[model samples]
Structure formats: structure tokens, C-alpha cells
Target: MYIAKINIMTKPEILDPQGKAVELGLKNLGISQAQEVRIGKHISLQIDAQNEQDAKEMVENACKNLLANLIMETYQYTLTKL
Candidate 1:
């Protein structure tokens, strides 16, 4: 078995309203030190595969096909044996 940890975020050029809102809220709460805050999604999946390469391919496919929006978002993942 393997585990995949995926992180998906909006492209750098894309506007992130939710991230802006969170930054504003942080500032309102006196967290002025926080700067350029961004929001993203983290996903973990348990996969049964023959090897690391296969598990990685499956995770990448999932990210490209369903998890991240290629037009506005990007993704990265880490795979580990479970």
C-alpha cells in the first residue's frame, strides 16, 4: 500500500478571493505580520499498487483529471509507502 499527499493551489497569476479574505481576517485580528497569504487544498489518498512508480502515476492522473484545475490551479504530491 502507498499513501499520496497532494497539495493543490491556485496559479500564481490567478486571483484568490478566499485567500484574500483570510488575509484580511488575519489582519483584522492583529496579525499584521502575515503577508501574501494563500489558500490551498491538501488531500491524502491510500492506494494499493505494485510499486512506487505506479502509485505516483495514479496520483498524478487523479490530480490532472479531477483534483486540480489546470487552467487556474497547480498541484504537487508526495508518495510514501504505507
Candidate 2:
């Protein structure tokens, strides 16, 4: 069996209001060490595949089709044998 871990995030050029809010909140809480905080999505899945190539293909397809919005977001994944 194989497992896939996907991370989806908005492009840097795009504005993230939620992230900004969190950053402001942290500053108010006296956390000055905090830098830019970008919010993103993480997804994990298990797939029945024969090899790493097949598993990677499945993950790519899923990310392209549903897991991420290609227009505004980018996605990366890691596949591991389980």
C-alpha cells in the first residue's frame, strides 16, 4: 500500500486575509518573532497501487482535479510505501 501527503496553498502573489488576521493576532499576543503566516491545506490518503509511479500519478490527478484550485493554488505531494 502507498500513502500520499498533499499540501495545497495559495500563490504568494495572492492575498490571504486569514493569514494576515492570524499574524496580527499573534503580534497582539506579544509574539513578535512570528513572521509571515500563510494558511494552507494538508491532505493525506492511502491508495492501492503497484508502484511509486502509479501512486504519484494518482496523487497528481487528484490534486489537479479536485484537491486544489490550479488557478489560484499550487499543490505538492509526497508518496511513501506503507
Q: How close is every model to the real structure, measured as TM-score?
A: 0.96, 0.95
Candidate 1 C-alpha lDDT tens digits along 32-77: 8997788999999899999999998899899999999999999999
lDDT of 2 at 39: 98
Weakest 10 consecutive residues, lDDT, candidate 2? 31-40
Residue 33 of model 1, lDDT score: 92
**lDDT of model 2 at position 29:** 100
Worst 10 residues of 1 by lDDT: 31-40
Clashing residue pairs in candidate 2 (N, C-alpha, C atoms within 3 angstroms): none
Models, CA RMSD each: 0.7, 0.7
Error of 2 at 24 (Å): 0.8
Runs of candidate 1 exceeding 4 Å displacement: none
Tens digits of per-residue lDDT for model 2, 1-82: 8999999999999999999999999999999789779999999999999999999889999999989999999998889899
How many pairs of residues collide in model 2?
Answer: 0
For every model shown, the clashing-pair count is 0, 0
